[model samples]
Target: MKNLIFSLPFFLTLFFGTHVNAQKISDGQTIEINGMSVTFNILNKESVEAGGKPYDRYKVSATVKNASDKGYNIRLSSYPQIVSNIGLVELNCINATGAKLTSKKIELKMKAQMINVSYSAYDKSGKFTTNMIPITGSYYFDPGDTISDNAIFIVPQGEKPDVSVRNLR
Candidate 1:
């Protein structure tokens, strides 16, 4: 019983360690998740003044491609994270003049056909129009579709941070 108890913990750790390890991804590398290929890269980094304080600004780009035959709806805005020696920094956008910048989250919808009909008996001028309103917080990907967008993240000055994208499966 004593030998079994000692070996059981070791065996359990060995069994679970492989599954718990996260795959380390380098910069500008692409990973496929659920038939969607995601690529994240830090384009540019510089020092900028935001809210009267110096901060590090990063221009990051993310691209997603749908390689599957089916469509998928996924959110890409919340996937990027910045980590430094001080730990995870809050991601936000700020301009050079210390003004907070608001970036629109990229949301894509699968292309679909829509039919609009107008039936007017007394009106001589009958027109059909389609209006599209942008929706926030989600995006849809169709087969063979690709999209790329750039965002800015500001962090404290003098901090060297690394960008990582959370797995989107």
Candidate 2:
């Protein structure tokens, strides 16, 4: 009886204090990344060369348009950044016969806040080009990886920015 009395308050708090289905919060407004009033235009993607060989690695790219009056810096980390916030961004290239081809790794990069960041993907050649797909790995943008950054540009209020991924031999 004593133990029940002691635990009653705890149980009550747990049962009553929690919300069953609270609505998610939203700002309804977009914020500039890395102090740059730029907008991402393209999330381009393609197959990439892996380990100096033409493998079935899918390459991912993102393009941002500067909308700020001054030069705006941007980086991959400023966005979802690989397999982090958005989980693994995956692309698949499969063959008709259901046979696996082969794949390799490719570098990715973005520049923001005056800093450059890079990322990489693995090759899955045996999977086939038709099924050649790329996704987010368990890694984020790091230094010395393939990356792209647009020069500081004075974007007018209505201009758009762009970014993309390329498939290279």
Candidate 3:
């Protein structure tokens, strides 16, 4: 009987341990996408005062892994926009100065998933850009590698909307 009681506590922890790491975020949530593991968390956002102007901004981080023994290419792209869900927008990147950079759109073939939009960057300039800035095709993760996503978003001027992000396994 003593052994049974002692084992009961251990059993509970094993049964519920997997769910303890799941998380969620707002319209612009930082999600980690790896094989058999995904996590979501709300991003910390703020505007930089440059030339006396405010640029709306927020950032989310993600890590991707190749996991396979061989060299593999991983492409990180946006999911779709949430539909009929007010006060929400999807953006791919933000610069160090807090200005949103325009980019080429990425289409995620998320098999009939509920996500609504995928936004990537379109770099028309041939100059090299890096750090706290939004640029497309600037970085890509490789085998046995992890990287930060740095997803960004802004509230439409003069209006605020409620949002919720669901973390899916």
Tens-digit lDDT track of model 2 for 54-142: 32222222233334344312234334464223111111111211113322211222332333334444447644233333433233333
Predicted model with the maximum TM-score: 1
Q: Which of 1 and 3 is the better model by TM-score?
A: 1
| Candidate lDDT values, in order | 0.52, 0.29, 0.37
Cα RMSD of all models vs. native, in order, equals: 12.3, 20.1, 18.1
Clashes within 3 Å, all models in order: 1, 43, 11
TM-score of each: 0.47, 0.17, 0.27
Which runs of model 3 end up more than 4 angstroms from their true locations? 1-40, 46-56, 73-142, 156-169
Positional deviation of residue 51's Cα in model 2 after best superposition, in angstroms: 11
lDDT of 1 by residue, 1-169 (tens): 9999999989999866633433333448787766767676768888888668887876767676777898755443432323122111112222222236723222222332233434434334565544544334444556888777677656678753344333333
Candidate 1 ranges with C-alpha deviation above 4 Å? 1-26, 73-99, 102-140, 160-169
TM value for model 3: 0.27
Tens-digit lDDT string for candidate 3 (10-116): 98897566344434333434444334122223366565443466544545443333454544332335422232221111222212233455221111212121323
Clashing pairs in 1: 51-98
**How far out, in Å, is residue 110 in model 3?**
20
Candidates 1 and 2: which is better by lDDT?
1
